[model samples]
Target: MRYKGFVIFTLFLFNIITIKPKAIDEKDSLYIDNCKRDLLVLMMAYSDEIRDIEVSEDNYIYLVLNNNKKIIYDDKKEKNKNAKILDADIQDTLEDIYPLDSINSVLEGMDPGRGRSYTFLNSIYGGNQNEIEKNLDFFSTYCGNIMFNKKAKAGEALKNALNEAKELADKDNRVNNYIFPISGSYNYRVIQDTGRLSPHAYGIAIDLNRNDSDYWKWVDKSKGSKRIEEYPKELVKVFENNGFIWGGKWEHFDILHFEYRPEIILKSKFFGDTSKSNNKKWYEGAPLNDEIENIINIINSKL
Candidate 1:
């Protein structure tokens, strides 16, 4: 009986020593997992433009574009929110997770998808004003002539979103007030009080009918919060479902603004919910097929 007991204990101890912990935090921890997640999301989001990823000797990751241009994933710099908005890395831009569910109140100190990565933008979209203008095609909406980028289907997405919104307006008269009289789109202008080019400058953002209480700068938090709640949820939903992020959800709320940011939306859709504790793979919830599986393999092996 003592011999048997000793063998059993030895086996148990060996098993405990040999069994590996799950790769829950593979590289660094949640940070590495998040980096991989963001990279994969970007891959799935812009599959047409992003060709492959490059890992450097010093351990820098880059998104290799079809045009042979490479954009760094993270500079490993420490920057405040304002600094990030001005000059942001892909990491910094995607750090703030945008909530998909409707919000009656404003987000505090976080504007997911608000910070513009000019390096990434200029790579996918046009670089200079002239180059960007060349990619522009005037899109006709109830908001009048709004110019949108032809590259990356920015124009098509905007058209589809507005067309759906128009159908919604047809059924619900209340939606019309918010859909019509769009403020502007495709203006090659810097944001007021800042040198950063507006998302509108990229022809990816559309501003709906103006309200004095629509913007954070224009009104206090009380009024902005009221405007958000008062705004038609369906209208916002329509835009979001069509690959847009609502400015009303931002800390620096621009209630009338909706920008086409598929990467942000993809992350929200695929990795938003934390209830999937049963997931064996990190990329479990995302739609899987040939290309995505291939990307997943590459990410797992590389990252």
Candidate 2:
């Protein structure tokens, strides 16, 4: 009887050990469901924007959006509008414009915009699905960079660049110098003639402390070719590390402007080193300015 009782007790313990929870914890289950829902939304958004999707080995998709007709229309419009009547004879006077055949040939070889390209590639190239989903939030939220100035698919590149920027900003203390909202997109304009969409439209760009910055439009063109100065090197460095390029680098500069143009930066070989090219460095052995010191002190006190 004693042996039988012992055997029964052992079996009961084994049964308890083998038993699984009958239901998932409600909070955890809810979180998982929400994540899945968010991912679905992101995938749907991408699908809606692009076509010709083929999965790559890396899990990114290669897709194309048709734009050849639009380019051809633009070319023809320019040519027809510029035909001039000189000495009673109508002459086609636009010198440098390419022939329609050339434009068509070029368009035929070009890929669709960067956003679509990256999305398709990413989908097929296959990284962590959860990580990709998180990136959707990062892109959709405009967490790191502004969107491109046009509706073309390259907007996805801006989103990816912004994500890289956010990661860098979180690591750097100089980011505290500005109190701008690092997340969410802003509305801004592109050069009117460029026919490009503003990056902010795609929800990827951030503008900081407009009051402190200078813009070329604010300056008188009659002033004879003056350049709008850039923000401090420290600030520019923080931005560049996150895959942004400063407008201060442009001849038509907007000092407060920083956009996610990682492709440009990468192709231009402008890595994030914003220190003075000379031996003199802005932050090296230099005392923090009164404003910066005060800000630092306040931050330290809080800590």
Candidate 3:
């Protein structure tokens, strides 16, 4: 992946100068900008699987998969917070911005990366339990041996993260206490009290050593915050660097939970909060290469 040099490039319109907004209003401008950003990151993170993007005859946007499937960009529906999670489109799934920087306190009523697009997940990982199981393999993590989906480099990323964590454990005994006896990974079950399939169902989430205060519903925010404070920041850094989002960062915190979500990480790492951006191009900070340049060209041309 050209991701090794992630110093992003900016796209100019047909002219070298900046172009005017194509949307009807400022609100629409922001919406379209977000769609473009999300689509860009998805293609970057899943470069091999998410083959291309499309704009329907009616102007609706879609992400076309290698299997020739199309997932909608935004349904433009009026949805309550609960509705967003229960029935998420690609737009709803990435609506909440994940914080890449280390945060000591749990988010308030915001669970980024919690509401997932099953269509997107299934497209890249697997369609069902049986298909997912075919891709599962046991990898030796420093925490313990656990099953992970071999697809999309999920298993490889997990092993790499833990390998670095194990190296950190050598100097800091505290790190060992926190990660040793990893709770589990690769359980094909739905999330508690939800109809949606968990990332674990696709063998992409891992739980580190558990603590009673690690869960939100089990305890309370006070306890969750305390656990978050005591938690080792370096350990969290290692996981994030390897493309996992910590559930501990969520309001509905699951401290032990770390799921592989490279698109989310890449989005935050590159094009964060476009409103604050002063760049001439939407993908301002992204690194460029033949592959990334090609993807950017497709988005620029199609969108």
Which candidate leads the pack in TM-score? 3
lDDT of 1 by residue, 101-141 (tens): 88898888888888878999888888989888898998887
lDDT of candidate 3 over 1-303, digit per residue (tens): 465334333343332344444334566767777788889888988877788899988888888888898888787789999888787888887778788888887889889888888888888888988899999998986566779999888999999999999988998989988897888888888888877788989999998889999998899899899999999999999999999999998988999999999988888788766658553577777788888888888888987
User: Scored by CA lDDT, what does every candidate get?
Assistant: 0.85, 0.36, 0.85
The parts of candidate 2 lying over 4 Å away from their true place are 1-175, 179-184, 188-196, 220-230, 270-303
Each candidate structure's TM-score, on Cα atoms with residue i matched to residue i, is 0.87, 0.33, 0.89
Clashes (N, CA, C under 3 Å) per candidate: 0, 32, 5
* Worst 10-residue lDDT window, candidate 2: 67-76
Output the lDDT of residue 1, model 2: 100
Q: Cα deviation in Å at residue 146, candidate 2?
A: 9.6
Q: Per-residue error at 118 for model 1, in Å?
A: 0.8
lDDT of 2 by residue, 61-160 (tens): 2233232111010111233321221111101211111111101011222111112122222332223334333333333533433433322233555554
- How displaced is residue 146 in candidate 3, in Å? 2.1
| C-alpha RMSD (angstroms) for model 2 | 25.5
Residue 206, candidate 3: C-alpha displacement in angstroms: 0.3
- Inter-residue clash pairs, candidate 3: 7-286, 7-287, 8-285, 8-286, 8-287
Q: What is the C-alpha local distance difference test score of candidate 1?
A: 0.85
Q: How far out, in Å, is residue 66 in model 1?
A: 0.8
